[model samples]
Target chain A: MDEFASIHHWTGARQSAEWQQRRGVVLGIGDDTAIVDVGLAEEGVAAPKRMLLAVDTMVETVHFNDATMREEDIGYKALAANVSDIAAMGGVPLHALVSVSVPRAWGPERMRRLYDGLYACAERYGVAVIGGDTTSSPEHLVIAVTVTGTVEAALALRRSSAMPGDAVFVTGAVGMAAAGLHALLAQRVDGAAEAAHPIIVQAHRRPAPSVRAGRLLAAHGLGCHALNDVSDGLASEAWEIAEASGVRVVLHETELPRSGSMAAYASETGMDPLEWMLYGGEDYALLGTIDKTSVIAALELFRKEGIPFFLIGEIEAGDAAVELVRARAAGVSHSGKQEKRVQLAKRGYNHFKR
Target chain B: MDEFASIHHWTGARQSAEWQQRRGVVLGIGDDTAIVDVGLAEEGVAAPKRMLLAVDTMVETVHFNDATMREEDIGYKALAANVSDIAAMGGVPLHALVSVSVPRAWGPERMRRLYDGLYACAERYGVAVIGGDTTSSPEHLVIAVTVTGTVEAALALRRSSAMPGDAVFVTGAVGMAAAGLHALLAQRVDGAAEAAHPIIVQAHRRPAPSVRAGRLLAAHGLGCHALNDVSDGLASEAWEIAEASGVRVVLHETELPRSGSMAAYASETGMDPLEWMLYGGEDYALLGTIDKTSVIAALELFRKEGIPFFLIGEIEAGDAAVELVRARAAGVSHSGKQEKRVQLAKRGYNHFKR
Candidate 1:
């Protein structure tokens, strides 16, 4: 039932020399998005702009329920999640094909409202809703969106490009969406959590993907940068980059960024913000690594562009693994306060396992 | 709950100048597939090849049930349906993204079996299984596949290209799949239908899409041909071509091809084979129109390629509608076995309506 193991099994079974040697496939499965050379340019002309292909599916009870999501928010978040994958590949989304299995209970009005949200997001991102298929499901509603995007040839970000001595960075704050989900779930009990934390609730409902920041990073062409979207929590994503790149990643606990609202909500709910920051997912924030020498310029560029960028850790030359450097309490440490390195497990929203 | 009406309403609501005027969009919604320019060549160079995009979804109980479809067939047909769309557009499929929502009861073994069928189809068509998303569903299993393909810039067939005096044609026999389904369903009652009609049963389980035939028609470039796939049966597809092209179509009852097994099965079950041919759907045969002047050459080409081609009808100048010409029995006819023209309604497998 492990999702990753299942994916590995089928993907391995399907791989063949014919598929691997296909003329224009630059990169295939196991990445944020598949990179394809659409053969846009002529043989001797400039290299063709590569296309990024990605798909994401949202099921009724698995990804959302009526209590946690509105009909419109369900549609919006479904497409947004795929767009976030395009962003993680440092690409600009161009077209989308949405396939939805509607339950009869939704009727036509709710379906229209769902599309309203989809159109709104499409307008915001300048993507064309080209085509899709619609069918009725006997029970649950399912939405699967496939997004096609354009990325500069040779500049598309990948999870396997992080190198040793790279500075790991994150855009914007983490754990806001997780905190929002917690608050929404809490509303069922006290009925006050939603009104008390509107920002986090909205964050959970409609996460703004960091497409512009990702584009800027790709355009800047910083040294061997690796990029991934934090859809499955910071810990899981860091592990993805580490395992893919064959490098060790170290994330400093003190440097992990958190929104003020998330901190407030966490304290009010008597929860540890760090737990949400590391393990809670669906933030849609950008997690990446840049060479140490280019870190200063990258920070300056982010500052100039008014993008929230935080240096959270570093990539070290070692076996593929992710470690969290936590600051221990003074009394607990043998010597005064010391930093404790903890190996982080790959834990997050695993579909089958969950 | 009219599927076409719902599609029309939403597509109209979503249409905007930005989407309609997007740089590379050749065709958008309301077609077998969307055509995109992809900007392959530079300015003043040769025209770039266009890309074809299409998607189809199969939901449990709605599209199939355990009694009718095996897990592998479900996977095969889900992908085959989208590939048929690409064929209808005169394109060669290149890549596919599959998003599957599996119910917990199926387990990993059944899921892998489902993918086995998908990989078989992919390999047969020379398509790469580039990317996809997998998730858990609380109840029904849903499979959505999006396929990307390449077509000649100007030679891609369209439903709106039929003209007066065009000869309407179909590839292979019709109603075999529907007859197969009928036999399979009858097995529950009689317990002998499937065993009695293995050819029709196999046809229903694995309907082969006319990819090569479509490619030949596109390559021939025979006089502005209009093409469509018979996913929704002959009557419905004829209505689509008629409506899209603003022409009247007349299908001859005597010309409608039927397989021997289908005819035998229909007789045994006391079911009208013509009814199945017109309204049962999921045959995956190619239905198209070629200019009368080029019909001879087109037939010759098909003969040389050893592809089954049948001239079933003709296009005429009139308002958008489909008609069927049936010869009456000698004793019943008022004027000694005269031909009677009957208007064909748009009847097929409509998702919402069904």
Candidate 2:
């Protein structure tokens, strides 16, 4: 089975609400930060205090490269990975807890560099590193970053809240990470000097997060119904939003945004550029749905804020399928699967199947 | 040069409040959770709401078995690892977010089983699974569990709170996990048939968090000035508490509790039983300090509450050291190294290390 099929089968039997009675779990798995409801300080309040929390991990070889990357970049990327989740829910990130599995051979300077990187990222994002655990491992370094944020009950965007007819949108460009990875690996493939110094490398190393855009969307009453970050590329994540929200997304082929880095890498590799644009991972951008009526104004607002994002598709009332609306150059009807999905198959990234 | 030495060198130099402020961090690296004061909630609270958060990662081969472990056990142990951290701090755990990295070959059934295990553990601990990311990898399964807990301002315990003369104590038996792992590995080596048994496997599989002990300790006035879990064995953690609290400790060997299982495993493996007891990890027990006068009463109350615990040592004014008082054997003396660590040469539960 494909990645989505397998995920569906696995998550299908999951009963998220069955465990809700456990103390402090205000919100369960289907949302951004599992909301932990607490009444520690408030006395006789009719409602419980809702808080959000999440944890994410990065491995040395899997999520990043320890040898080539700056310690600061690793630290920043680790924290950014979690912050993006908070942003997806239209929440304000508050603090972070970090735990690391350091290789025994790594000396003090490496740790300091890692910390320096963490410090820089935390400061840039306004989140504090409150607590952490450190231990030695024989091999790869592992970093687990947990962050907490808060959102008003009325405005919190969730993955399960999308309504039919909502429009699909994504923040920034996608596929830059995929392109950047290709560029980085190509440099190593032939022992070629780092000749193609591209911006895609930066995108893969540190794609900016959309915390500000999410908050702005929430505050402006832009009718965003559901939200999630595009860490796992656009096509795969679009399918996720559709499945979670029970909507079908029909994406326009011409509407997708490809960063210059993505295009250049595709050209250099002789691969379909749009596939990378749609299916790349670690972009750390937001993929959200808003009422179709609110799209134009939302676009204008993002433009005014200098945030590069675009409306790419619509949530339709049908089986969850992503369709490409390309006029056939020759007069021949085509299957949506063949014309759209197969064309973008290279971009799809799944954790279990990638 | 060693793990502790590296940690000390990395942390000793860059202690700065300015770094915290510049990062928009209200709290930075040394606290229970770095506090980044966020904007006021629209609910209009009289005071800013405080949230406690933490993240920890569990690797498949490094932290658990890739070949023989059950999915539920994997999930439970992964979440429990982080929950144990919250419990050590005298906090009430609220919610958790878990990020998982698994190989594509693991299959949907394995994924579901893992989720089932996580759900079971979360339900028991009163924590909800919030949001997280999942991706495919070619390596062993990696789980990063982030948990959030809450406490009133006056109640939260921190590592830096220990004083010169605090009494040191631990909840429940130590070295059970080290013993457990040793038993499992030995059974594998000897080709013991019972290695497939559920209970024996589960002992190495799922670890219960000490939430009750933490809550009781925090609620009562029985002071535990410094707190951390017995994750890296008693001797190693004792040194950490001593160093963090700025004191030394002396352990009476007779006071250290040893289970029959631990003794049998040691005897079978031809390993020093005491070494396993002293240097084992993943006990999931709380090791902490309080006033010397309150030790007996605290232990009694714990017994009444059906929480198992023992007082094994005392904190003193001197360079931090652990002096073993001979019970049935010769006493062993340990002191903080120049690196400020009462070093344990071995790290617990790393599979690939020779």
TM-score of 2: 0.82
Candidate 1 residue pairs in backbone clash: A40-B40
- Model 2 per-residue lDDT tens digits across residues B31-54: 434444333333456332344666
lDDT of 1: 0.84
Candidate 2 residue A166 Cα shift, in angstroms, is: 3.9
Task: Assess each model's interface with DockQ, reporting 2 decimals per model.
Answer: 0.67, 0.34
**Worst 10-residue stretch by lDDT in candidate 1 chain B?**
B327-336
Which segments of model 1 are wrong by more than 4 Å? Answer: A43-46, A189-194, A329-337, A350-354, B43-46, B189-194, B329-337, B350-354
Model 2 docking grade: acceptable
Candidate topping DockQ? 1
> What tens-digit string does per-residue lDDT give for candidate 2 at A194-303?
34744777776666778998888777478888888888778777776777777777777678877775776688779888767677787878888899898888989888
lDDT of 1 by residue, B222-307 (tens): 76479999999899999999999999999999999889988988887788888888887888889999888888888898899999
lDDT of 2 at A59: 71
DockQ of 2: 0.34
